[model samples]
Target chain A: MDKNMVTNARELTNTEFFYGHKACAGCGGSLAVRLALKVLGQNSFVSLPPNCMSAVGFLFPQISFVTNAIIAPFAANAAVLSGIEAGAKALGLKDHHVVGFAGDGGTADIGIQALSGAIDRGDRIIYICYDNEAYMNTGIQQSGLTPYGARTTTSPAGKNLPGSIKMKKNMFEIVAAHGISYAATASIGYPEDYLKKVSKAAQCESTSYIHVMAPCCTGWGFPGERTIEIAKEAVDCGLWFLAEYENEKFTLNRKPSSFSPVKEYLMKQGRFRHLGDDDISIIERHRDHKWEKMLKNWDS
Target chain B: MDRPKVVKYKEPERAEDYPVGATFKAGHLVQTNSGWRTFRPIIDQDKCIKCLRCFLVCPDGAIDKSGESLEIDYDFCKGCGVCAHECKVGAIRMVKEGADEDGR
Candidate 1:
């Protein structure tokens, strides 16, 4: 680890790389981008897709990013990062980092192919997916990363259905399958852990990807003040896990002895309020299955 | 490529006056966002532990920690109350926007 690693909040830079945007109050995605940019520093070349961060940060006549940044197309965030990396290298730029901030819809649904190609080509870029679980910028619509039983504008809860019937795509494992240089799963609730991952990604010589679970207060139907609390509860309840893949091995950073009740976490969010006991059981069963596989194969 | 000139925003009278590609300087505070806030966070300096948790968690970067005492930049704070909610010692309180003597 480098001496510049931010192990605590006080060590973080006072210089705000992201600020003065129109993001909703207590927006987790914006916070994630802000904190990651702090870790990456001012020399970072940031590429954001047409997600909440870009929509809110790149307002015309009032741009937010202090570092050099541009808005990439929704499906070309990774490709743009790759281009930035190659262009910087050609220009003989030193001590510069090429990073991308894409949302779940941009990463898992639209930008996944471009991301895969970048990793396959061994491009030296950092791709951070601030997964808010759905397409929050364009209203609350379900995406491929939306969890099962969560109510979205498109996937409503009613007598016949229990919201989204599909589970979130395993983005971390999928990225790791490419034998990328570095990959990690993070959450805004655990800022320190997420910061460490961002730092590690910046240090990678080749492509690196970090999938961070950022909770959205407006989309999730929760009080703005409760964003951090709800994000922590999600991980504590076993819905999200912190892990990293390096050197062709997976390591779990946190292994809770026992998980908190899933119902308490679900009932707090408006999206999951309509879920029944059967739906809750199904979610728990899936969580247990995932844990069983991870505990058996992954190193803790 | 050379760094683009930082042009101040102005009402465009003609198309030729606009900056190339409509580029704006990064991190330029275009306008104050205080109007968006319904509540304001007031920090009790005596009770604050200076943990810097609130500083790191602020989405708007409204909390200023560079001075001897932490200051809340009301111009940009949207008053989400996350800092007050995350305060371990209840040092930060969210007051309704117009309830105070300042009437703001």
Candidate 2:
């Protein structure tokens, strides 16, 4: 069982990420930052790259972080985090969590080399990718992590093709390949779970990675209000999977008794709205197969 | 839009007063812009059960829960109506940001 931040009775958490930062209305990435910081707290430091998070939240003088945060290049967050960890050790600093919070593009594509190198070098860092599916801050261009059949500015739907036919790069599994201490998939809708994951990851003897599914209102073409709603729907419909790899063991969390159909999740977003019944069914098939593979990995 | 206040850094003792960016824009960020929002959610205390549902689902962290009843900080709220939408009991409603009396 996971430890709860639950004090006494009410499920409230003191946060290190504050408002007044320039995140869009109902931004899931913003919430992810808040929850992650809620666990990591004032002792934590964030090394952000040139993603939406760095662009808006920490807009120079008008910053929003309640903890120490620094900006790194798109491909160098992991490298920077490695240095921070080394420096902390050299100075004999304890309980300081150096986090590399990047977007999907930064993690799965541009920054993969540094991330793999850091993992291989056994850096004690908490690396989190708050994935909103595409390069949102740069105007919604589809990246390697964008799911199949979702439309982006680069992968606009046309008569020939529905949208992006590329399957999202499996970042969670790939990070696990390096044989790190911990890695997991989490979503903004599941705040306590994400918070608990961060809390646990902070105590890891080695690198910890969390790939958070953050819904983008503007990019996904959903109402700003539905950011949390669609996030929950993503998990409820099995489009997004939550599980962890800790102590060299795979454990899945919160499986629905009956997954609401893939359509129930897809139809909510305009990007996936272009998807037809055929596309949804095909996606559903993939989802089921992915869940099966995850179960197999867990039982192994 | 007004820029954030930049605080001058002093020695170790005063350094604690200034955080990461050393900007004093903490709580004053909500309604600083002229064209920030078109709608805002108003809580109906009569129907509220204090479930903290609205408080939890607020993406911007705009809802203030310090008081006995839940209140919204107009400055931080972007009038997203997410709180209104997420209220399971329909205890919140989205009011037009400017249609009625000038929303402070």
lDDT of 2 by residue, B34-71 (tens): 25778877888999998887777677666666678887
lDDT of 2: 0.79
Q: What value does the lDDT take at residue A53 in candidate 1?
A: 92
lDDT (Cα, tens digit) per residue for candidate 2, span A102-158: 999999999999999999998999999999999998999999899999999999998
- Number of clashes in model 2? 3
Docking band of candidate 2: acceptable
lDDT of 1: 0.90
Over 4 Å off in model 2, which ranges?
A: A1-11, A14-16, B1-35, B99-104
Q: List the residue pairs that clash in candidate 2.
A: B30-B75, B30-B76, B31-B75
Question: What does the lDDT read for residue A19 in candidate 1?
Answer: 78
What is the C-alpha lDDT profile of model 1 across A136-221, one tens digit per residue?
99998999999999999999889999999999999899999999989999988888999999999988999999999899999999
Task: Give lDDT per model, in order.
Answer: 0.90, 0.79
Model 2: how far residue B35 lies from native, Å: 4.6
Off by over 4 Å in 1: B1-8, B101-104
Candidate 1, chain A: TM-score against the reference: 0.99
* Candidate 2 structure, TM-score to reference: 0.88
